[model samples]
Each structure stands twice: as C-alpha cells, then as structure tokens.
Target: MSTRLRCLLAASAVALTAACGVGDQAGSNTVTMTVWTSNQAQLDLLNRLADDFSAQHDGADVRIQSVPQADYTTKISVRLAGGDAPDLGWLGAPDAVGMAASGQLADVGPALRNDPEYRFDDFVPAAFTNWRGGDAVYGVPFSTSPFFVIYNKDAFATANLPEPAELAARGDWTWDRLAGLARDLQPSLPRGHFVFQSNEGSVYGPLPVSWPTLDPLLRAHGAGFYDPQTKRCTLDSPAAAEAVGTFHRMAFDDRTAVPPGAQADFYAGNAAMTITQLSRLSQLEGAEFDYGIAPLPGGPGGQPHVTGQAGLVVFEQAPHKELATELLKYLTSEKAVRELAEFYPPARTSVLADAPEIYRDSRLSEQAVKDILVPGITEGHAFQYPRTWPEIKTTAQPVFDQLWSPGADVGSVLGRLCGEVGPLLKQAE
Candidate 1:
C-alpha cells in the first residue's frame, strides 16, 4: 500500500470498524459468505439462491448485501483496506483492473480449472479481458451488457418520428439523427420533461461511475478520458470537444436533453430516450408506458459498441477461502447463470445461444434481441480505467461541472480538465 492509501485507511479506521463486521461467522463446518450487489430488487431471488446453496452444502450461510451503485467502489475500497472485505462482490469492468492491480482480488483460476463441470471454457473470451491478469483469472463476468438506446415508443409516435429501430434497419440510425429527434420531440413534451437523459443518471459522477455517463458519447466520437498506452489525458481532443459540444447544445441551446441540474428518468416516461443495457430492462418490465430497444446510434466513430460488465470476484482477504470458492462455483454454474440471464446479459456462450428465445417474450422482442442486444454483447468493448482514476475524479469535479453551462466553451473546458488530471493519469501506478 502507498503512504497516501495507508493514511486514508488510518483516518477511516473508526468508521471502518463500525461498518465492517458482517462477513465472519464462527461455527463447525459453517461459513458466512458475504456478497454485494447493486440491485436490491433481486434480493429475494439472491437470498433464494443462497438458501439453495446452504441446503446443498451442509448449511453454510450466505448473505447478499446491496450497496448503492454510486458508492460501491469507494466503500469496497475502504472495506478491503480495513481487512473487512466481503467474501464475494460484483466489480464493474472499469473498476476491476484497479482493484486487481491493487492486490485486493483473488485468483480463482485453479479452482475453476479443477471443476470440469464448471465449464470455464464456456465463458465468452471477450468478457475476460478486464478480469484476467496474464494466466490468472481474478474474476468472471456475470453481466456483459452492451450499451444501447432505449426509447419511449409513445413519445416517438407523438412526435411523428420513425422508431430508432426503423432508422437502424434503414442504415440511418446515427448520433446526428438522435440529436435531431430529441430536438424535434421536445415541443410535444410538457414542461420539465426532456427528450433525452444521460445514461445511468449522473452526467459526471464522482466515484463509482465516473466515465460510464459520457463513455458512449466520447467513444462514439473516438475520444476517451485517457489513452491506456500513452497514459495521458485525452479529453481535450477535437473529437471529445465535438462530442461534449453536441451534448451542451442539447442541454442548453436546444433545451432538449435533461441538464445537469434537471430531473428526467427514461424509465419513468419523463424522457424520450436513454442509453442503457439489458440489466436495466427489469426496470421497464412493469412500467406503464411502452418502450423500444434499438442499436446504439452510430457516430463519427462508426457506432462504437461499448459494453459495461459486472464480474464476480472472491476477495483475497475473505475469511473462508474454501467456502467462498465453493459459493462462487455454485453461483456461476450453468443453471444459476441461465437464471441470471433472464434479468441481466450473460457472458457464457451456452446461455447466449438460447438467450433470444428467453428474452423474446420479455421486455425485448425477439427481433430486437437478435438484432441489437445479442450482437452488442458479442462485439463490445469494456471500459477500462487506470488505478489512479479515483484520484482524477476527485481533483476534476469542479472542472467537470463547468463544461455543462451554456456559455462554457467545450474545448476550453475539457482542456482545463485534462490540464488538472493529466499529471495524475501520467503518473498512475
């Protein structure tokens, strides 16, 4: 651990002690496995799975905890630093490398290989990129969900705009078209309603989801927060400015997109469209209004297929390594994975082949699933961040806020942002 990280741990000692006693259990042949998830709605389902595991394994206890997605990364970091890490937790692709590089994650590769029925080879090769370090597999992706646009069907009908699916079918689905559609759809909405909302809520998040909101926009324009190879901030590139300027115009110039301070939820029918993944389909399963799924809008980068992943990992410091590995194996077994795929996108090749049939009657139509969702998961890039990314976010909060204003020059704002975080990115690791 670095001197700075040790200082942070020492400063947080009190709170960590109070908040970190949930993972250990003392009994004969009994283990309390702590699991973390972002979706609380699935608590009942997860508990049932845990119950089943306990029944099968001589009553080893399992507990699933849901942490707010916004604070997940930081809280996990604090817990690990305090030696109170959960037995198992879900880590997103962008956050996985940082945690593994920090020596916080465990390698389950050997256990997986020893269990022939586990069929580790059945997992998609692409989904393992962020979870693997050379020959060691630190985690396995449970949700390899691709970012796609979900739109309000009624809003499109009211605005007399062709559905995004139709546009995509005709090879006309593009970011420029999406902006125009948002602008044209605005007049039909009531006050406080917008045509579009940023993906997953925050425009510039502080901790857990810093890049996801802007990732689709930036990558579609061939821009990113930083270059992985060069280890330099690149948000000041012309392509990035163009992408940011486009969003700025929608928020301020056209007043079509929900701004930083405004409220709009795509699932609530307050916005016409949003960029999200299959895992979010459950939110719309019982919504009153009808929704539509479409391929992500193509841009100068030719429809960059970006994906976000949730990989399951056993913490290195977990109290029961043997029991935790057993739980991991059971949770990711073929049957359990198929059940999870009913809600989130699956990374296993076996389930993916039959996924369209399963989702055909769900929120997505069979055609939409095959056309957009399946291809997206199969051919998408996971967003990777450097180990020092949290530091960059902390230092760049003020500059990020300045980029959303009406009078803010997009290039200059991002230039200032890069200037502030560039050194951090350069010196990462």
Candidate 2:
C-alpha cells in the first residue's frame, strides 16, 4: 500500500478501537476538551477526529470553537486573559514568542517524551525550533505551509513572458529578474491590474506577501532586523534601508503589484502573478484557469526565502489541559500528519519522507516543505526569517503611503523610515 494509504488505514484502526472502547463503557465519562480552530476545513477535520477521541475515552466530549480569521488571535487572547479560555487553542507560530511569555502554554516536554510515536525529531527543524524554548516543547506543529509565486498562466502567455517552469530550470528567475518582469509587464496591464495583495489595506497585507518571506530577501542582501545574541532589532541598518528602497520601487514605481484593491484580479486572469500562501491551494480546488507555482525568486545572495506560519498551543490554565496536550500529540502523529497531507504537508520530517505525494503538488510548495523537513537540505534556511515582523510593517505604512504618490523623493522617505524604526528595533531588544 502507498504510505498515504497506510496512514489512513492506521488512523481508521485507531478510530475503530476507540469506538469499540466507547461501546464497552456503560456510564463512565472523561473530561470535556475544548479546541479552538481557525479555518473551516481544519474545524471539520478536527470534529471528525473529535468523534474518534470521544469514542475512545468514553464520555470525553471534544467541543470545538470555530473562530473567523479576523478575530482568531484577539478573541483567543481575550478569553485566555479573562480566565475563560478553552483547554486547547490555535496559536500562530510566528506569534508564538509573544504568546509564550503569557505563562499559559504548558511545557509539553513530558508529553513529547512519553509519546515515542509522536517523536520530536520527526518534525521539520524550523517547526521544531519555533515550538521549543528552554528545552521544552510548548506546542505540536500542525499544518506546514510555504510561500510561492502563484502566477496566472494565461496572463504570462498573454504578455509573451517566459514560462515559470523554464525560469526555474534555468536558474535565471532571480528576484531582480522578477522585478524587471514586473516592470516590463506594468505598462501592458490595466490601471489596477498587477499583483495580488492580501490584507494590505487593513494592515501590511498577509504574512505570505510581506514579512517572513521578506526576511530571507533582506538577509540575502546582508541585512537582518534582529541580533539574536544581543536580542536587538536592527531594522534601521543600511541593509534594511536598501530592502525598503527596493520595496518602494516595486509597489509605487514599477506598479507591478497592488495593495488591497482587487484580489480576484489574479483569480480572474487580470493579474499576472501573486506571492501568496500555498494553503490558498484549498481555494483553487475548482479553479478554471491554468496556473503554475514557483519558489519565490532568489536575490543577489543566491537564496530564496519562503514565508511560513506555525501551529496552535494549549494553555496551562485551560480546563482539561492534559486532555488538550494528548489531543495535540495525537493531531501531530504520523497518522494524523498523513491524513492532513491531503490538503497540507505534515510538519514532521518522518511524515514528509513517508508521504511524497504532498510534496509533489507544486514546485514552490515542494521546495518549502523540503527546506523544513530536511536539515541543511536547502539554501533557504541559511537566510534569516522574521518570526514577529508586524512591527516593521507598522513602520513602513506611512513610508509606503508617501512613496506611492507622484514624484515622491524615495531616498528622503527611506531615510525618515530608518530613523523612526531604528529606535523601535533597539527597544525590542
């Protein structure tokens, strides 16, 4: 049987065993474990697993709270601080550092240690590293995703541009080359049709289009926002300034990308390319247009960085927190990993190696999964990736606003941004 098929079989056996145990239990009951999920599909999957979990534990109820993406973090935080938090909840990994300071997350070291089936080493290094602090596992990585340049195949051909496949094969599709392509295609596109921007209007767009991916680019250019040893934010350094300069040109000068206007442009064949999350692949199930995915273009530094987000952590104070931990362990098991891989890649290396179909979907997503699941496996990790980069985006808003206008002095605008953000970085230390 195929690895994926075997994984499904294992999960089915586990579920069946749990159900049989539930049948045996006449009046016994276990604690109710409440789990908060962000996406609908994830909630559905969790609900199904909850049925299995409940059946196995007899009287153990798994209550799920589905939160909209807009309100997920804020709502979870409010509940956590108000002392009414669920036993288990989703915590985006990039935001994990700040959440870790809350004292709510249980040190999952014991849980991981006791469960050999849910081995830590099986995880992608980045996923494992983000979940660990002080030699303890705080959370189990769930869905693993990577950033990619999703292009409208029709648009590319319409402009007579080289195919993304050829670009990747030739190793000539660097960030500089992409910038040039964006510039060249700008005049051909209608006034507002260019690149797709995520939540740029409300904040600084989505994680995929902005910060984390940008981190590798900045690092490739010899710039990093933080000094880990000193724990300082070095965002205002010269390298940072150059990175910002390049961004200003991309957004305003070249008009290759758009901010928060018409997302359907790319989906509708109006825009040529979009730097977006692979998880968005779920949205493409019935896509009518022919599309191709490629890794984010490399820079002069010869490395391409793809952005990613981490999984949910349970708080220590939550009711049935132990059960919460158990659920987390179960969700990240090789069995669950393979099941989830039907839509998303497993966060564990063992699972990745065992299930190759997940990585076979698209070129860019494949590279991203490869980087996380294998050590020194690719050049992507050598470059820095920002964990909490929203602060930088906060500082860039006004700068970008000014630069986007007609005849704005790019150098002066960037100089002001450096001066403003430099102090904030030092304070973040």
Candidate 3:
C-alpha cells in the first residue's frame, strides 16, 4: 500500500470521518459550500462566519469540514481527483499550482475583478503568485502564517535557562544556539520530557519519504529540496545534509527533540520548545503553564522564516461557482480578514498592519504579536515549493527511513532520496 493511503487508513481507524459537518444547514436551505480544514478552531470560526454568510445569501448554508492534518491534503486531493470537489475549500498554496495545472481549480479572477469595492488589490502580490497565471487567479490566501518557536515557560524556568523571549531580546536567538539550548536543557527536563519538538513530530514516519520533512531546517541552512527554476533535487547538498544531520544528532545523539516514535508534545508541557505556527495556538487554551512565542532561530541562513499559506479556492467542478465566489469574497474582505487575524493571520495588506490589536483578545500578548508573528508574515517568503510537492512527498517516503537510525549516513541516504525523486522532477520539466 502507498504511504499516503496508509496514512488515510491509520487516520480513519482513530479519527473522524472525511466530512465532519459543522452544524445544521441555515434555515434548511442545505449547505451551499463545504470547506475542508485541519484546524478545529478555524472550523468553528469559519462556521460562525459561514452562518452570517448563509443568512445574507438567502440562507444558503456553508459547511466547514474538519479533517485530520496528517491526511488532510491527501484526502482532499483524492476527493478532487475523484470528481467530488467541494464547492469551495481551504487549500495549501504548495498544492495550488499543481491542482490548477491539472484543471482542478476554477479561476476566481473574474468575480474578483468585477467588484471594485472588494479590494482584491489590497492582497499582497506575492500572496497570489502561486495561484495565478496572468490575470487568472486560482486562489486567494486566507492565511499567510509563518513558522515560529513556541516554548514552555515552565520548562525554561525549571531548567534555569533563558526563554525565547529573553534570547530574542538579547539578539541571540538562532538555530545553532537553539541546538545548544536543547542539549543544555536536556538534563534539566523532566524524566520523560525533551527540549524540542519539530512540527507535528512525525518528521520521519512508517514509510518515511523524508524529502520536505526537514525543509524548515533545510531553509535554516540555506538549502532546499530542489531548485525551483531548474526542478532539480538538492537534498544531497552539503548544507542540506548538515541540517538534517543536526536534527538526527539532536534526536539520537543528544536525545533532545522528540524522536520518530515518541509521544511528547509541547502544548502538554512535555517539551521545552517547539518549532510551529499560530493555528496551533488553539492547543494552548487553559494550559497548565505559561508559554512564550518567538521567531524561528536565526542560522547561517539568517533566520529562515517561511510563511505557510492556505488560500480559499473555488473548485472548477463546484456546482455553484458564482455563489462560491461571492462567499469567497465575503469571507476574505478586509473586515473578515481582520476578524480572521485573531487566529489564521491575514494576507490583506490593510489588515496585516493591524494584526497586534486584532489578536489582543487572544492568548498571545501584543509584544509577541508585534515582535514575532507580524514580521514573520510581513517579511518572510511564502514557502517556495515545486508544483510536484505531493508527488515528491509520496515518492520519496520509503527512502527516508534509512537516515533515522543512529550513525546513519546522511549523505548516502539523501543521495538515494535524490535518485528516487529525479524522475518526478524530470516529468515536471
């Protein structure tokens, strides 16, 4: 079985069904659009906004479906490919181009252009690049959230170590120092706890196609999976190997980051620090300890900050494209964007400027919002990924398991990965 399918199977046994419906259809008019997301908070918030949307649009209800993040992109991509596209949905920018090229996405440009008051131009130009071809816009980013560090304040206090906030204040927060801190704090962490956790903590899994699994570290080292323009794999480069090697050393040698088969979580206070983004803030509610948020550590690559993007798109096969477009406009306008900034962050330039205040009611303090969150979104590059990312992730999985073991040859493992993905890249060209 393919790794992606296995993810679906495993998720189904322990998780919710594909479309966990939001609420009752507004006034029984039935759901007009079904949007998919991996975030519970976002699902709830979008459902609330969708309620008002339904009221305004003759009671055309909108359903927000929540899926497990582990298999979300795969499940939704499979659905779209199987002729069962949602009327509208939350799609990752990485997958937008490929889906658009495959004729799976509808060009939303016309509806956007027809309405002058919508302020489509208010969106950052870079936000639309992956989803556009000339005047054709396949998607508009609803979330341009950037990756940052979330540290357990209690862990820092217990270890007698400076927190991320202090490090950022001293201009000493960088990945190298982070590595040292992970090790230095290890002896201080509770018996079963660690010092760091990577995004999702599934860096290398069952089948382990480990390509972009370590991309954040790759970027921190000024390396990437491949050169976008050339469509060539760079996973075997020295910098790339060194970055992955550092994580491996942390996992096996230092025993700091949660390893492949571990069960610790930062939000649960089992970890001292973790590299993650905002949507995860929902996990912090009513937590047992205070937590500090800070920018991703700087590195030789100079604080590699990559904004993870999700855009609202109307699928081509959607039955009510016009209505879907209208709902899209309503949900992404400046007013709605400001409201969404409380969690998802915003792509609208006007709304982006006022993020700190918009999020004042949330758990994050204004300084955290201004110093860490806003800059990561405003100045960070939208994660530049190949249109072939889904293919690359699937095809490269099996080859990555080799490098997870102690003393595993990083260079050789990544070389094999490059070989596995070479055919996929060539086809892209």
Overall lDDT per candidate, in order of appearance = 0.76, 0.57, 0.74
RMSD of each: 5.8, 7.8, 6.3
Candidate 1 Cα errors over 4 Å, as ranges: 1-24, 36-41, 51-59, 65-78, 207-210, 285-288
For every model shown, the clashing-pair count is 0, 3, 4
Candidate 2 lDDT at 183 equals 77
The predicted structure with the larger TM-score, 1 or 3, is: 1
Best by TM-score: 1
Q: For candidate 2, which ten residues in a row score worst on lDDT?
A: 1-10
Off by over 4 Å in 3: 1-31, 37-84, 133-135, 206-213
Most lDDT-accurate candidate:
1
Candidate 1 Cα deviation (angstroms), residue 269: 2.5
- The ten-residue window of minimal lDDT in model 1 covers 1-10
Model 2 TM: 0.77
**In candidate 3, which residue pairs get closer than 3 Å at backbone N, Cα or C atoms, i.e. clash?**
174-298, 208-397, 209-396, 209-397
lDDT of 3 by residue, 260-358 (tens): 778898888888877777777888877899888888776667676667788888988776677788889999988888878776789788997887778
> Is candidate 2 or 3 superior in TM-score?
3
lDDT of 1 by residue, 256-355 (tens): 8888778888888888888887767778856878888888787888877778888888888887777888888888888888887776788787898997
